[model samples]
Target: NRRGLPEGHADVKRMMTVPIMRNDEIVAIVGVGNKAFDYEAEELEVFARYADSVWDSIQVKRVEDALWQSREIYRAVVENSTDSIVRCDVNGKFLFGNEAAIKLLGGAEAAPIGKTPEELGFCPAFRHTWDASLQYVVAQGFPASFEFDMEIAGRTQTLDMRFAPEYSPTGRVVSVLGVARDITERKIAERELARREEQYRVLTETMKDVVWVLDIESSKFRYVSPSVYALRGYTSEEVVALPVDHAMTPEDRAALKALTLDRVAEFESGSLAADHFYVDQFPQPCKDGSVVWTEVVSNYYINPDNQRLELRGVTRDITERRQAEVALRQARDTLEQRVEERTRDLTRVNAELAAAMQVKDEFLSVMSHELRTPLNAILIMSQVMLEGVRGSLNERQLRAMQTITESGQHLLAMINDILDITSVQAGTVVLDRALHEVDALCAPLIDRLRAEAATRSQSIDYVCPSEPLYLWADGRRFGQIVRHLLENAMKFTPDGGQISLFVQPDLDRRVLSVRIEDNGIGIAHDAIERIFQPFTQADSALSRQFGGSGIGLTLVRHLVELHGGTITAESAGMPGSGSRFTVQLPWQAPPVGSPHGAILAAGAVHGPHVVLIADDNPSAQRVMGDALRAAGYEVLAALDGIEAVATARLRPPDLILMDMQMPRCDGATAIRRLRQLPACAATPIVAMSSVVVPNDRALCLDAGADDYLAKPISADTVVDVVARHLAPGRSLIDAASGADARPS
Candidate 1:
């Protein structure tokens, strides 16, 4: 080696340099000087080996320093952590416990080192669950987590616990490191959130308004309430899957899409508040192929959890409200026009209507007399002939006479029905109330109509309780009600059809129900209400097949109502389906401890009573006289009111039947004159007439008649009236005072 030192350098005889390498990089240098000889190969090799050993030692020292620094950092973290951290051996003996762990047990004095949880006096419940989790980690060589309860200080704490197996260098699980977090407040918050969610779900599920959530970006429903199905005929799941505009019409869909985009843009631009509502109305199509109007109220909001912009809304059906608005607008538009037109026509129309009504009232009054007078003669003669008064009749002759009598009676009934409806409409009809036995009132009607039912080969089934049930009503009108209802049933029923009458009296409700059912024809459901209107039938074709003025049921209903009752008609609208008419009438039982007295007593007069017949028509006088004479009574006939007074003065008859209309003088004037006489002052006088209006009946009784009878009288009615009056203890009837002299 040549000496190449600078002027102040140290002198060296021999020198060698060795490179120290670690991981293929130079880490340090080793140099030797003044070795007393030149460096040999053996000595250099020895120095190289020695340099490698020294490098190994430096690496070990570096590793030790790094590990100690890492352990100090771990200790700091474990001690400062809020979570309780501890290490336990495989036998569950505590190896170490951090400050938090010691605090969790109680304090520094209660540190868990060198003690199992049992020895440390931990709650058994927490210890069991924690120890099981630790043992599982040791056996499975994995981490385990659980939730447990531990009593710390004076309060029980809910803690989330985790156990992890600590492995040695050979991968053996030596001990378990446990960490417990106090999550009591967090658990309470989660429970409260779950409870609030349940309440929201319940409210949305039950409410009729549809609640929904829509994703702003996708324009699709994210959640929909169960009520969406009721609102739009789409299930919640189906609605959630469908686009927001699926229920809208094509035009509405396009409009709504543009509107929604504008709304979102407004929100983004900060022009609209997040809590602001967007309310709109549009028509939506239903699954049933119908369109309905809907109102949607929505608010744009960003979901806090997902940071998603969403629309929360409620929708309601507004079809009915919209329709009402349209109707109101139309009515408002036409109101002024109609008012002007009506104002112009009111005076003239009023005059015309007044004249028409006056003429109509006069026509009905005159027709009642003109029609019933001849009807009376026809009915009287036909009835007399049928009873074999003149001679015996063959079967065909009897039926022919019967047919004539029936036709005349039917005409008379039509006239009476027209007058009745007129009186009912005018609200002038008055009822003559009397205590009547229900059985007695109903039996005669059934017997009278049974022959007609027999002609059609049909039978009427009559049902009534055997007990004596009474009703406080007009007996004659009640009889008329039953007859009309039964006739209606027979008319509609086919030949061989069945009719049933059920009479039920309810004492508790104080009502009587009369149900008339027939197996003939049924009415249509739509026409059930129409049939109650005057001159309206269930079907127009029925009028052709069945001869009716269509006013029978109308009159029946009016009469029923006048008697303080209600009537209902039921039918199925099919032939052979039959019909049912039920009538409910107010019923009142008689006084409990009172005796009922008859209006007139028969058989009180010992001798044969004279009944003077006074009338203008010879046929009427002859028919009445003949019927009276056959009833074992002395009969006097007068063709006019003049002879009637004269005959009564000479004879002083026990009873007098006076006709209202007569030639020369009317029966009213004659009765006044006859009452002036002492012998005839107390005599019972009945006024008979063809005009049966309420005023007409009042007029006759006001003129001192005991009772008033309409024309077309039956022989039984005439005889019964005479017998009742001729009996003793009969008082004069005062018509002006509203006294009823007629028997029930």
Candidate 2:
């Protein structure tokens, strides 16, 4: 049996088996016996053909089984899917629908197989769209998608529907398979996100603080709010185009860069929390070249777009807050110093106390300048009008103009009193002493107050020496002392009261004594010294009864002390007993043959002197020009220092009245520049300014000005200054502006 030879014919000699197949399945087996010889190729070939048929049938059955299995899997997947899946015929009739589809159509009642979307109670508005999509898919043999809103279970549902053409064996589109996703919840979320974004936009746009986002990698702003213009003086687009540290100074920029690097290191090291915020304060430079302190609150976040860490910050100006903190600290320091020096000598304590009170002097200086700048125009213009410079005025107009001038002067006095008290207490007042006549000072002051007394039905009587009384004193302070005493008399005295002034000269002691008496509201004996204190009236009730700042006598006493004189106040402690103030001054005459021995008259004017008035205020320029023109001088005005320099170079002036504070080029700078010019070198330059302080005149004079004039200058002062400065052929006699021109 191991060899090719038959082991044994066996019991039956030869046998063969054949497999019978039906539909590729083995139905039966047949056996044949007594075969003659071994099968030849021809016989075997026929048998092989039958066997090949059976193999073919088996292959076909395998393919059919696999296709059926694939169909079953596809059906299972379609049924389990959450999306609504359905098939429609070319005419839009439903061929099959899954459970999701039935649920989408409201319990299968509204939608059923073999029914079109319209026939199955679909939205009428969507019916045409559905039919059109089906037709398009059928015609183009391509897939299509659309979205529509529908009602399901008594609620609105938004569906995103896709249609694909189902092809036949011949590649012809038979029906459309639709898959719809109910995106109702997704749409609601999207709408809510949009609304919240709009609300955020509104908040950031309208707020005062600037909100911005920075791209860390680019080191530039990614988004900047419109409010950036207010905080840093840059537009939103402009800021976005700039570097993040553009508004920072060089030192600040370096610090900020270092801080950012540290923050980044902290973030990468996991030492900083993801939602941590930072607060920073620094000085930021503005577009206008000014610097302001700002507070920045920021947080780090990863931008979803680039998946990179970025900074979102809110910036607000804190310059005013910083100033307030500084002021508070200064106040604390001042309080400590006051307590420490409380037991020192009176003079030393006073000087130190004055130094401590200099904190508000800067603010007072600014306020004084601003108030006096406009007031200069008002007073000067009113004076010019009253003098009939422009034209003649009727009686009514003259009276009105006089009232305006008086009111303006009253306001000026009050302002000066406030400033003078500050200056005197601070011990910063410097006297510009000059020769003055007692008659000239007392007579005009008496005349000035006579009208006010008449209005109150009061009579003011004054006695002066028949001969001119001469003394060495500051004319302005001398007048102020007398004016305050006169005003005090008028303030305390009742209507129809009598006020008297007695000027007595004692040549034996080289002293002059002046006495003023009022017949109403006498001071108490105990408060005689107290009345001379700053901001103290004789009686507390008198403050409300008579409207006065109560610093008049205080200023008067300080001024008299500054003049090397003594003043005394006497009262009888009884009403109607009257009050008397006596001031005594030791006189010193000018040296014989000295020019100061005689009052310098405004010498003769040879020619129409060309005077330049340089001021920034339009009204001030106009008034000064008119006043100079009325005084027989050719006047030219420049709005600012730059123009003044240019004008002076073009047409040289005999005298230049330059304002200290002006736009572009200031008076100090202009004067210094003008002095370099050959034509202006010898020209008389008088510096004028509204800011009245001890050092202001020095500053003006140091700027190459021959003299300085304080603001609210009367026409007489201007004329006298011009005449004295421009007297024939530049024979300089007394470079002083005027004896009466005093800066408060």
Q: Indicate which candidate wins on lDDT.
A: 1
Error of 1 at 273 (Å): 1.5
lDDT of each: 0.81, 0.81
Question: Model 1 over residues 1-744: C-alpha lDDT tens digits?
Answer: 365777888887888989997789988999888887788999999999998898898889999999999999998999899998988999999898888888887677866688888988877787888778888899999887899877877787899989989999999999889898999999889989999999999999999998999998887899999998888788999988888778679987777788888888898898886679989898888888888788989999989989999999999999999999999989987897888788768867988877987788889989888888888988999999999998999999999999998899888888888898887786678766544678899998898789879988999999999866656557888888898899999998888999999999765655689999999888889998998899988889988989888888888888887665789989877868999999978653433543333311211212235678998888877666655544445467788889998888777887889998888999899999999989899889999999868699899989999998999897669977886775542211111122333221
Query: Candidate 1: which stretches are off by over 4 Å?
Result: 1-13, 19-28, 34-37, 40-50, 168-172, 304-308, 327-744
Clashes of each: 1, 0
Task: Look at candidate 1 and give me any clashing residue pairs.
Answer: 523-573
Model 2 collision count: 0
Which segments of candidate 2 are over 4 A away from where they belong? 1-36, 109-111, 169-171, 304-306, 323-744
